[model samples]
Target: MPPVPAAVDPDTLTSLLDGRWAGLRADIRAEMAAAPYRDPIDLSVEEHRSRVFDQLTALAANDRAGLGFDKAYGGGSDIGGSVVSFEMLGFGDLSLMVKAGVQWGLFGGAVQLLGTAPHHERYLRRIRDLDLLGCFAMTEHGHGSDVQHLRTTATYDPDSGEFVVHTPDRGATKEYIGNAARDGRVAVVFAQLTTQGETRGVHAFVVPIRDDAGAPAPGVTIEDCGPKAGLNGVDNGRLSFDQVRIPREALLNRFGDVAPDGTYSSPIEGDARRFFTMLGTLIRGRVSVGGSAGSATKRALALAVRYAELRRQFATPDGEEVVILDYLGHQRKLLPALATSYALHFAQEELVAALHDITDDAPEQEQRELESRAAGLKVANTWHATAAIQAAREACGGAGYLAENLLPGLKADTDVFTTFEGDNTVLLQLVAKGLLTEYKDAFQNLSPLATVRFAAERVLGAVAERTSARKVVDRLTDGDDREALFDRDWQLKLFEDREQHVLGGVADRLRKAAQDPFGVFNAAQDHVLRAGRVHVDRLVLEAFVRAIARCTDPDAKALLERVCDLYALANIEADRAWFLEHGRLSTGRSKAVIAAVNTLCGELRPHARTLVDAFAIPEQYLAAPMLS
Candidate 1:
């Protein structure tokens, strides 16, 4: 927006992170080598899921496995390092990545984050060792994203110091739970907590599903979900508890606790806050998934780039079928996504770091902030991964569609990303709500109009800054001055303001919907979905802008400029309506934006390989050669 920073180089960001993935490369490669190969899409619903469980077991068996879990409990080391290893799994296979995620990220992380020290010591090591495979049983058949109203319950009893778990109906049973059938010996089940006739909201519990010999535990009935559109290597299932009873200690007593005397107390006040805090622990796992999605995008883009470099098409009179990478259209389709891979990688590093700091005994407020960051990054990265992988697949023409080529398979696995770990659309709505809440609290008003008004004032300030500033960055750099270009604070302001604007727009839309319940629900769907996407896009752009600012190399800076240019233009063009509606850009400026995108595509053509090369995904990891 502010004369796309001239000096910021693309390679600068790559070097800034200093190859954090280097140390994990050997383990990543070895895991890829040792990992079993399974065609999830080719199996029967039952066999497919069975294979998924087996794969999970196989991954857990590795000594270097569970790197992301608690080191004291049979894990490798740091959660950050584990994430690095998980991401690289995409290079070998997507199903393995996904099945492993359900196992460790969801199932194991639930125990790690939601469970207390006692629960962790008692069951976590077994989970890590695969002696007790488990499922994260939260989503019910009827309620997927709406977890608050789940129909299952855990009622405390002083008679035997036990609580009864029951799923009153079909919808109440947990559904679409990974690793639930055939393999799981335990489950981290979430059910309403009721003590002394007072019903608290959703709480997590550790429930044993099988005996030592792997037989179904008493009163728990598990049914395999059979099959679905994607993620076949996951043994998804539904479970119903018929008056199932377990010790009162089964509840994960980290955030809240229940004594043997049936007294319940939580460090957090209010039913709503307690529920949210428990759910807030999920942010780390979501952030971890975002990192994995980033890897998926890289793998897919690498495949496309390699194929494009070698696959020739119609050429000029000079007589050569032009390499697809030579085509401006292909560059337009692929290079920005390649740049996004960079953005996602750096942002993920930041998110992981933020998570580490907040989780390391920081105050509650800091933890909440980390959760928000995790939410924003998770929403942005997953949506980008799904879209990028699909685009990369199509960019390869036919080969991408073949299973052998991997893109098609990768796409299938990533497709579920939009739905699981909180639906992309739903997640953005939550982010919008979070932003609106902050706006109201910061400004001392909850009204949507008040929030919008405050945001409008902020925008005015930004516009004034744009008008009166000394243009500190403009004087700093001219043509391809990547460093000074990235140094401009205006770009960061643009991102901040853009997010606020979109969030305000969503609030306004929600308010309008309140006027008529039915009409608003129907109309708000598309409007809210759009706002959510815009917010995520702004995040991606902000990350790209920040990374570009950190670059020092001249050539990488130039290439990064091309990348940033394409990313900015492409995003703005997609949201032409917002620009026009808000008077941010005239029709002529919008046309120029489109033209700028085209120019960027041409400028970045030769460097497409160079840009992706910076992702540093080895050829062996890709299982294919560049320009082959």
Candidate 2:
């Protein structure tokens, strides 16, 4: 069970996982140390990637590459182990982390999830060994978020028993693809499958990009996307296929199959269902991205907090270079973000575990539920990561801008996160669509009397939305006295209120638009998307609360609880107008939200380093001194 109301601790939380995993984490750090280039901004794109591939080769050689995979794939670790190790890579550099992610999480995972037994036997080891690097060619220039609209097509030829893959025009070319510029021998290209005039939705094809001689394959056009704002170490590029023919077996037939006679069959019947199932496989990538983003944010905060302690500015009357952390403004800027970093870290762990559970044993619907959760978590965490890193950089002043300090590179590298895997806005819209479906399902289950109950419940749900911080404050200060209402539950509920209010806002808007559905949907896409984002935000907050409750270490638990409070408080204050407009909180309570957040920021200021330290990043991966 999770720790009780008042005794939550951080050390207990970290202790839930085996500390021996830190050894593999250390190996990754050593691999990073041995890399040719430590700072990517200082190296040309080719040089950066060349060095990254070299480092990846070293890590793969040492058997550190398979930690989170199955033993059959030469991995000795599980999902938690993989996450712990991958998060540590952020301490070295974000670009290296992305490149490593592509190699293991994408290429290897694609084979594991989408390929059959023979496919794995033929390509898994090579992918793991880096003997045959590959890129996931799913996104297209004309249809990034809309995977169903891709123009690339694969037509089957029964006479030759081959699939002719072609990107008919420039708009259909795969772009922003990692590992496409150099070293990839094959790609898991997604294209429309057609046979006998019946076109199936997107399917993954193992298309060879380079011949055995390491030269470009015929009919394949690969071009570099050039130097990007971040992840320079990744060979992000564009690929266009022109009637490229591959054997019938090239199709990843795990869920669907293509026969020698040009017949295509899938257990999933609908074109849309098959497409969604394929997209669901990418949720693991989203989870990994969330964890990676959290790790990077933690590293940035650690650097900024440590520097603030030693590097001082104007002092008090006693005459001393006061530590920047001594200023409330500095704490305000960095501490809450630090708190959010902690929440995201714990939340990501839970998401990974939840995904592992469903993928391993749950039914199809359960797996889809987990998939939605992963998508939601990805949107919430990554968006927060960009904001958190920027805050950490600004808190460090000019030192942060210096490439040597790692902040500028960290910022540049992480900038793409909000877009990669899925754009933040697009993903949130997906989450919104999911929420709408869920609501409709729940509403449909109601009978005549239950319909009245549902109506009443909806009114109550709208009326009782509570901000997380206020919940905590009420518990902490409930004696009919202002301070007596400062209960932990009150603080937690106050935090929950923010989420409920936002969701209610969307519900209210949609309810009003029930009269003109198209106008509401067409004109209010942004609002609908925002509502979906709010629902996702609520889900993440709940997960974070649950994870902290599960931590065993008392002090760590207590600290995490405080961090959770800060995270919720900051968000509530940031969106106070929602609470006010919804009649959930008064203007006075709204102001109280800001004051409480500020106060909590001050309380967390002292333990900021301790919170990030609990992450246990290896020394070499630590990047710099976190404290004087």
Candidate 3:
């Protein structure tokens, strides 16, 4: 059915992971090597930050910054290409990637996305050239996720015709701002804008935070956050502004604006609409994070799987030692993760395509849909990186624990990804809301007869799926129908049906929830998250299937199909409890799934090196001596 799964052929491996941009990645890698970015793992926070600053300066001098901006401001205007390169940068040093992202993706991006042409014309070229280093000042001590409640205020002064920005209390201090401690000269700060005695919600302003010689400006207080668990190379710090004044022109007034005379105006009418629209422009950050996380997952899986190939454990009766990977337990931990790493890789590529579509002038609704998808995938991929990296560490045993192995660093650095960009939980809640919103919209315009039919179909579909699941589980012929059991169509169908069942149940529950609103929604958080996971899982699998379908070579496609099958079965095995509870999997069928997964792992073990080799990490950056 899957054209007889074949062994991986090294000749076609790169095409599998590169998606549609192997050349672009190669070009980026070459440019990165020419720049000769260094990791400098042993430097202290201060020393490391200084070293990174110097590296960034070198990059800026090389005209390597602002890769995503339009050519008018000295950038290449290739958003997809830029993100591809940024994702590859993660394979080297995460701190460097993050610091660069801080400068280019967050700080510079705020101006590029949220600001009008004036902000770009006056500052972007200098920002790209490193003449004006800026920090994205958004997250505050008291308000990380709940930014709507931020206490920082930028009140307009009619007489002075300026915006006076102030942190009302210590809690309003900007925390964990990259480049703020030492190098950044300016900040794109977000604060509640007040004019004519009315708050106009959160807005961005370009304000100088540091003056000549890197000193805090007149009313700005700066403090180094000191050593962190990882990414010590970044100069993350806290800042508080006490009545800092900036010209009215400093406002990045694309979405909303304050007139020179202190009057407020915006094309968007509602406060909520304006807020979301402004943040939507910054969705590239989430997209970039997902891409980077996918790359990081590949690197870790490659490093660990390669080590497992060479590292020997207990000897067989013939006095020949077993390659640790020969053990079932070892393969269980690493191989499925290997498959998942592949899944994330494909999902990230799909995200990039969706982003390109939006950038190419897709409708506003399409852009919002992609934004929600990006948020979900960002959460999924980052969580995958965290899990995959940890599994890689454990798979390698003691050596993996050593810093030189790279697992230690990968784990610590990626752990924060689950929190940043948006907490995974919060982001999932967003996904759930989107799904629920769509569900409501679907039913909104239905005629009375059509509404009844729709409701009847949903209810009957659940009943049919439940019945079909029981039959599927009972008919599963253990390993005899192994080929049928692993059918891509069947596997995908089961996953989708399960998702449909869950969504239908949740929709009914949420309908009842409309009364209490707050209490019901809060109580349904776990269900909401389940819906998000199932949705993401479906997206990942769909992407994997489509990628497999596009493979030009036979051997590569067959082997990748196996990996895809592994990803499918591994997830099925992990969620077997849910399947069983829902009558989608019988005990025998579930056990068969486990056996099939183990078999797939053993089959893939021979190709482990080839799999990781496709990651194509520069040996210098990978620099894990054990890997060599």
Candidate 4:
């Protein structure tokens, strides 16, 4: 284990974790501390919704809502700052965090990014100011993950110069639309557009769902989805249209448009390509979801760690009670997860900066890479939150299960994250598809057979070539397995080698699908998913490595190095069976990895409070009564 200072300053660590948006993070933290906010544990569903809506309105009043919008529309025009602000909200009520994301990051973002100049001029300011609370109505009963084939239609009637949006069947109804049950006055509805009798795939349109009197528009039907497992404060509902008439200008025509004469035109040649390009421009929502999930995980750990420190159990021979955190079992549960949280925090910071810096005119490959990273990280962060928060709750035992302690709410609220923005399973496949195709027409085809065939034809050679290169590099290792376990270069190579081998193996299995693509791909589905998981694992480790290099303070740097080691070694230990199976590690070396993880846990147990305190969560969010 590397030497860490006896006591490192948490504030110094905070500065490094804050990254490019430190000022904004500090301001938001201060604002949250001063705000009149309370956890909604005891509030009724309607009452909680009311409280969250008020908070959203107050955020808009302070101009915080305009941070990501264009300055031309009275916004601050700071993209990354806006995301950081949303992440900070996760320390408090998650319902508010989700509500704010729907308002600014999704609904407003669609208007700004997918809509044309006229749409922006008409809606962006209103959306920013909360004068027009809206729903992002994309998900439907039949098409959640497979959005390219949505059944809802927006048919152009040139005779009336209007588009009639309709739900042809029950499957076309928009399900779980945020704000639709009560608050939303309009919706950015996604539906298949038809012009001159030619149906042209999925496109977004600005459609009014409610009138000034708070009644449904003439042809719009809205039904509350009722209380959910969590996030009751969000008024999710089902929306269906019965020949709702919207003007020709309602189309958000950034990539595709229809003329008054019923002529359809698009800069992109194919429907799939254009729809995906539109989706790529709106990746901020996914990025924000992942960041918010990380924040929630940090809050859970802080609560659990604080309780562990104060709650004493069992007596030692010296006649003093041992702090629960001293137990190897408790440390094993929380410290590795804490270290992983640190790693994810750095990776998220990198992803946000990339999203903020990429130009609109950048190559398609860059955009695809950015989208892939966003998808990959969202899968990582949300799944981590689900697992880590549950562990935190269990770590605190009975006290953690109480609603007032906040872990219960955090667990329930974040549960939907794995499926809402994109199903984690589907998103992982998307990541794998991008890898298999090298970003060439990857997003254009998501069907199983197409992806399998594509990988067989295009990716097999690349995988083989990378495998050969890895072999040459492997022969150069120093052969001292025990000492090399802590070497950063060795860890990097092991992760890289594992990814190449898994990916190549998948390609080989897929190459035999010449007879029955779907059946072959289905049998090898687990392998396909593994390729995606390992690829993301490598990216996250690299991001953590890069972040450590950027640290300037010696004490903080030294502490972070130890934390990163725990992260790397713990992950390897968890997947040791794979290494053993592949002959990458001997039984003795594999046992050593476990011993190293245990040693790191004991070494880090004393500094648990300092490590979590570096997150600098608002004291209000961590105020569980048991901790007192």
Off by over 4 Å in 2: 1-37, 441-485, 495-518, 622-628
Distance from true location, Cα of 614 in model 2, Å: 2.6
Tens-place lDDT per residue, model 2, 1-628, is 1332333344444554324354555565565566544455478877888888887777678666776566776776476666656666766667667777777778777877788889878887777788878888889999998888899999999999999999999999999888888878889999999987788878889999989887789999999899887888888889998899999999998778988887878878888987888778767677878878877887777788778887889978988679898899999988888777766666676777676555444587777667767777787778888998899889988888887787887898888888888888888777776666646643445466755665677787744443434454444434442243234455455545655555555655565354587887677787777676666656656767777667666666666667777777777678777656755456666666777777777777777666666665554544553342
C-alpha TM-score for every candidate: 0.86, 0.89, 0.95, 0.95
> Which lDDT tens digits does candidate 1 get at residues 1-628?
2332433343444455435555565555555655545444456766766665666667667764677677788776577676666666665556667667767778888888888788778877877777667888999988989999999999998888998999999889898887776677888899999998999889998888888887788999988787666776666778889999989888888878888888999988999988988898777557767877887788788778878888988978989678888887888789778766776677787777666545546776777666666777777778888889989988987777777677777787778777777876678667655555654553455477866776676678567554533343233334443333333353445445556566655555555443575686567667666655666666666766676666666556656656666666666677777656665555665576677667667766666666665665555556642334
Please count the clashing residue pairs in each candidate, in the order shown.
Answer: 10, 42, 0, 0
All predictions: root-mean-square deviation over Cα?
4.8, 4.2, 2.6, 3.5
Q: Which stretches of candidate 3 lie over 4 Å from their true place?
A: 2-7, 32-38, 441-461, 464-480
Q: Using alpha carbons, what is the TM-score of model 2? A: 0.89
**lDDT of all the models against the reference?**
0.71, 0.73, 0.83, 0.89
RMSD of model 4 against the true structure: 3.5
Deviation of model 3 at 497, angstroms: 1.4
RMSD after Cα superposition, model 2? 4.2
Residue pairs in collision within model 4: none
Candidate 2 clash figure, as a count: 42
lDDT of 3 by residue, 1-628 (tens): 4554446666477866776778888776777666665555567777888777777776676544777887999997877777786798788778778888888889888999988898889988888888888899999999998877788999999899999999999999999998887788999999999999999999999989887877789999999988899888888889899999999999999999998788899988998889988888898778888888888888788888878888998899999999998898998988899888888788889888777656535677777788789989999999999998999999888989988778888888888888888889988888877777757843454566756766787779777877877666655654465876778878888878777777777776665454586787788778888988898998899999999888888888888888899999999988999988887777777888888998888888787777777777766666678867
